[model samples]
Target: MTQPVTLSVPCPDRDCALSLARAAVAGRLAACANIYGPVTSVFTWNDAVEEEDEHVLTLKTVAARVDELATLLQTRHPYDVPAITWETCSADDDTLTWLADETR
Candidate 1:
């Protein structure tokens, strides 16, 4: 059986978040995408510390889909260098099962 993975991506605006979330789920690039509320982000940009409030999304899917998912995200994302990060999850079996079944 293929192992599942989780992704956490940040979108600066609501429209972008909704668009990416819908596309990811519809295309099966991600099985699930949980859009979060506006959160404060402090990170370095252009060698300067910048602060911006942005929306966050948590996505879950299989490892086989990560490459395609990343491509889809980058193609439609608004930001030139948007955050399209993912991680392999090993939290628990139940959560892993849930992620695997999300597309269904």
Candidate 2:
């Protein structure tokens, strides 16, 4: 059985987040993408602490598509280093079926 996962990416703005979401869904790399934000993020970059407002993009896909999705995000993302991570999850049978069908 294919493992379902959610890929999380941080975007600098809504436009960028939406663009990535559309491309991923269109390309069949993801079944769905959820965009949320203007959330404040605090982190250290290049040896300095920084804070910024960002959007969170969550992509639903199977484990099989993760590499391709990550590559697509890297090519399309606006940031120098985009944060792309995934979490394994359990879903209902109907949701899993829908996700597989949509991504395929």
- Candidate 2 achieves a global lDDT of 0.94
lDDT of 1 by residue, 1-104 (tens): 65778887889977889899999999877878888879998999899999998999888898988998889888988888887788886647777676667654
In the order shown, the candidates' Cα RMSDs to the true structure are 2.1, 0.7
RMSD of 1: 2.1
lDDT of 2 by residue, 1-104 (tens): 76899999999999999999999999999999999999999988999999999999999999999999999999989888897999889999999998889888
Instruction: Judging by TM-score against the true structure, name the best candidate.
Output: 2
Candidate 1 backbone collisions, by pair: none
Which ranges of candidate 2 are over 4 A from the true structure? none
Model 1 TM-score, all chains together: 0.85
Indicate the residue-level lDDT of 17 in model 1: 91
